[model samples]
Target: MTSLLEGLEFEHCDAAAARSIRDTVEDIYRRSYVQAIASGDPFDSPSEFMRRFDSYTDPRNRGFAYVIARVDGKPAGQIWGWSLPENARWWTGLNLDIGDDLEEFTAEDGTRTFGLSEIMVCTEYAGRGVARALHDELLGSRTELRATLLVEADNERAYQRYRAWGWHRIGWLRPGWPDAPKFDVLIRDLDLAVNEK
Candidate 1:
């Protein structure tokens, strides 16, 4: 499996670069979530995905980073995230009470929390380390104290992968989006020492 990933190439893009490659990113997203889209899930539709993508890549979103991975010069995967602003509504729909302190974690400054919005690998590259590579490449040097993301509760594969990647469930959230499914809110502390290096 490791050998299969030898040709993988990764590119880091800022908000402007992300906008320039909007179509390519959307294509990768659709390919990555082919199954979910086929299931007729409204939330998984291309239009909906682009809606979220636009928000993530918006210039106003501080510290936005998008990483794309390719193999043999073809797009294989992508991962992106941005810092949440002070008093962000990211935790608004939490179904579980994780305490006021935890809820207030993002209240001080926008840089305190990094919100990982999306990470996906094409089906053909699923079992390889493409996803992990994209993930690490994007967050390994982040200056944020912590990072958080939401994953569908029923996505066992991704949930388990996240667990293996050092994330722990903090609570559940059903986003404000119409017909959105409940997602497991996971958080992981980021080691700032990495950025110091």
Candidate 2:
């Protein structure tokens, strides 16, 4: 199995791959999201998802970076990020509650950049740890000081997995679209010294 994946390759995605991403995202969202947490069935009505995906992946968004994950020559997952506007106008800041102080993590500042991003692995790749692998690859690549993600609190399984990776919840709200209450905030500080290879 390892050998089958040994030859796999990954590359940066382009505008042309938007359709593939849409399809993959739909598949992952379907199998991963539970009705209890999801606003309804957005996958069934793919319009909004497509619109959001297009805008998010638009190349005009400067400093954007997204990578495709391949396994045994098959596209399996993806990891991507972009610059955040100042003061988190684009949410380019890391919201880490280090128990005592509140600090912002940015890409330009030596202080440490934070990625408010996403990583999705198909169920077939679940046990293989592809999601975590993809995450570590991107997070480690640029030496970000911290990272944050929004997830559904009810999805205990995902929450536990994130916790194991040293992530902690910050708070809650109606994020983005579909009008849902995903776990308001979760953060992880990038220990540059420890993560550096």
User: TM-score for all predictions?
Assistant: 0.91, 0.70
lDDT: worst 10-residue window of model 2: 103-112
Give per-residue CA lDDT, model 1, range 66-132, as digits (tens). 8999888899999998888777778787765467565555464777888898999988898888887
List lDDT for all candidates, in order.
Answer: 0.84, 0.59
Task: Supply candidate 1's per-residue lDDT for 98.
Answer: 64
RMSD for each of the candidates: 2.4, 4.5
Between which residue pairs do clashes occur in model 2? 84-92, 88-91, 106-113, 172-184
Q: Kindly report which residue stretches of model 1 are placed more than 4 angstroms away from their true locations once superposed.
A: 100-103, 192-197
Candidate 2 wrongly placed segments (more than 4 Å)? 1-8, 14-40, 43-45, 89-112, 192-197
lDDT of 2 by residue, 1-197 (tens): 46535554666654446445677765554443334326555532456655666777776655456776777666677777655544453332334444534442322442345544667766666657676666666666555566667777777877887887777777544454564344457777777324542
RMSD to the native, candidate 1?
A: 2.4
> For model 1, which pairs clash?
none
